[model samples]
Target: MRGLNDKVTLITGAAGGIGRSLVRRFLEEGARVVALDLDAAGLADLETQCAGHAGLLRTMPLDITDHAAVQKTVQAVHAEFGRVDVLVNNAGWDVAKPFVETTPELWDKLIAINLKGPLSLQHAVVPLMLAGEGGKIVNIASDAGRVGSSGESVYAACKGGIIAFSKTLAREAARGNVRVNVVCPGPTDTALLRSFTGDGEFGQKIYDGLKRAIPLKRLGQPEDIPGAVAFLASDDADFITGQVISVSGGLTMHG
Candidate 1:
C-alpha cells in the first residue's frame, strides 16, 4: 500500500514463522525493514533470503526481553534509517503446560518474553516516534488470549496482557500522533505449533482438531498474519487504534 511505501519498519521475532512472512511482505511493499530475532542462524537465513533486496532489509540478532539491548538497537535503527515509521512487536515464546505444572520460573519466562519484551520495546521506540511526526505499532497477540486454550495458561495470560497493553498505549499515544493496535492470530502452521505437538502423528491430530474447530475448516498459514499487520501498520489504519482484530478463521467471534 502507499501507506507503507518507503517507510522504515522494525519487526521483532522476525526470524520465526509469521515473523519472516511479515519481513517478506513489508519488503515487497517497498518498506525498509529491520528484522530482529533471538536466533542468529535464522536471522542469517533471512539475510540470505533477502540478499537480492539489498537496501530493503537489515537483520538484527537480538533478545527482545533485554531492555538495554532493545534500546541500543532502536537507537541504532534511528541513526541508520533516520526514523522508524512502523513497529511490529511479534516476538514471543510459549510454554504448553498445565497451570499446576507451571513453575514460577516458567511463568516469569513467559511473561518476560511475551509481555515485558513488548513493554521494553515500546519504551525504547515511543519517544523517537513522538520526536518524529507519528508512528504505527502492531502487537501480535493470540486467540488463546481472547479465548483460553488448554495447556497454554501462562502463555494466554501474557497474550491477554499484550492486548490490554495495546489498548492503553493506543489511548496514551494518540495525542502524540502514535497509533497502537493488536492483531490476534489463530492457530497457524508454524514451527512453534509443530513444537507444541511434538511429533508427526500428534501434530497431525492437533492440526486436524484445530481445523475442525475453526469455522473455515482449515488452519491458518503464516501468510495469513502479515496482511493484517501490514494493514494496521499502514496509513489505512490511521483512524483505527486500540482495536483487537482477530485473524482467526471465525474460530472465536466476540463481535
Candidate 2:
C-alpha cells in the first residue's frame, strides 16, 4: 500500500465484478484511478457506486481490441496525468465449451479480447513507463491457464499466453524499473462465472465440481482478489516482478 498515494492506476474491465473490486481497492489505497470498460453503463454505475471517491476516479469506455483506440487512450491519459504508475490488465471474456465444439470465430474472439487486448495496452503504456518514472503491471490470469480446464481450452490458452507474455515483458522492462506480474484467480463468484451455469449442464457440472473440490469449500469472492493485486502494484512489491500469484483458495496449487 505504500507509495500508492495519488498514483495514477489504470484498470481495464473496471466495471465487472472483480474489476469493481480492483478499482475500489486502489481508490482506498489513495490512488488516482482510471477505470476502463466497454460497458459505458456499467462504468457510469461504477462512478455512482464510488461517489465518495469521485474525485479520485475517472471512467472511460474502451474496446482494448482496438489498437488505435488503445494508443489514443493511453496517450490521452499520459498527457493529462503525465504518467501512468500502474496498469491492471483485467479485461477478459470466455465461453464454456469443449474445444471441438468451439469454432474458429470463437477462437478469434477469445484471442483478441483475452490476449491481444492486454498486449495492446502494454504496447501503449510500457513506452511511457520506460520514459518516465517506471510503473507496475498486474495482469489477471486464471488457474485454468496454469492447469487446464475441461471446457476452456481456448481461454486457458490465452491466459497461458498472458503468463508467458508477462514474464517476458518483465525481463525486458526491468532495466527501466517497470514491474510486471500476474494474479490467477480460481473459480470466483462473478457475473462471468454465473454465465457459465446458464450455458448448460456441463457448465453447471464444472461449477459444482469446482466448489466441492476447492479446499476452502466455496467459490472465491470478488473482494478476495484486490489485496493481492494492490500489493503487487504497490511499492511493497518493488522487488517483485515476472512472478505469478494464484488467488484461488487451494483449488489449484503449484510450486
Candidate 3:
C-alpha cells in the first residue's frame, strides 16, 4: 500500500478477470500501469475505463507465449518507462477436463500460457530489475495448483509449476534486490471460470458445488485478488519473497 506512487507496473493478462482488477488497483494506488494482453480491443477498452485514474495507464498488445516477442516488449517497456517497478505475471488460460480426458494440444496451450509465459517474462524482466536496484514480481497462480481441482488437471499442473518457479526465482533474485512471490486464487468468479463451467444448467450445478465446498461458502470475486497483489508489488512487501499467498477464503488451508 505504501511507496507505490508513480511506480511503473507492467501487468500481463491485463484485459480480463483478475488481470483487470490488478490493473485498476495499481493505478488507484497512484502507480503507472502498462497493461499487456492478447486482446488489443480489451486493452483499449480498459484504457477508457481508467480515463481519470490517479495514475496513468498504457496498453500493449502482448502474447506471452512468444519468448522473443515478450523479451522485446520488456525492452520497449523499460525504454518507455525508464524502469519497470513491478511485473505481475497474470496471463493464463486453461480448459476444464480430467487428466485422462486431456490431450497433448490442450497441454501445450496450458503450458504455454500459464507456466512458460511467466517464465519467459521473468527471464527478460528480472535482469532489468537487478540492474535497476530491484523490482517486485507477483505471479497469479491458482488454488487448483496448490491443492488440486476436480476438472483442472493440466491447469493445476501449470499453476503448480508457477508456484515452484516463483520460489526458485525468489531465491535467485533476492541478492539482486528483486523479490518474487505468488498469489493463488481459489475458484474465483471470472470469465475464465464461466467458460470452464459454461452458461447452462451444468454450469450452474458446478458453480453451486464449488461455493458449497469453500469454507467461506461462496465463490471469489475479481476484487478479492488485487489487494494481495498490490501488497506484494508495493514496498509493503519489501521484506517478503518466495511466499505463496492463497486468497481462497479458507478453501485450502495449507500450513
lDDT of 2 at 138: 97
Instruction: Judge candidate 2 against the unseen true structure and give its global Cα lDDT, from 0 to 1.
Output: 0.96
After superposition, the stretches of candidate 3 with alpha carbons farther than 4 Å from their true spots are: none
RMSD of 3: 1.1
State the lDDT of candidate 1 residue by residue for 1-255, as single tens digits: 658998999999999989989999999999999999999999999999888787899998889889999999999999998998999999998967889998999988999999999999999999999988989999999999999999999999999999999999999989989999999998988888877877888767877898999999988999999999999998888899999999999998995
lDDT of 1: 0.92
Candidate 2: regions farther than 4 A off: 199-206
**Model 2, residue 225: C-alpha shift (Å):** 0.6
lDDT of 2 by residue, 1-255 (tens): 898899999999999999999999999999999999999999999999999999999999999999999999999999999999999999999998999999999999999999999999999999999999899999999999999888899999999999999999999999999999999999999998888777678868878887999999999999999999999999999999999999889988876
For all candidates in order, the CA lDDT equals 0.92, 0.96, 0.92
Error of 1 at 84 (Å): 1.1
**Model 1 pairs in collision:** none
lDDT per residue for candidate 3 within 115-192, as digits (tens), equals 999999999998899998799999999988989888899889899999999999999999999999999999899988
Q: Which ten-residue region of model 2 has the weakest summed lDDT?
A: 195-204
Count clashes in each candidate, considering only residues at least 3 apart in sequence or on different chains. 0, 0, 0
RMSD of each: 1.0, 1.3, 1.1
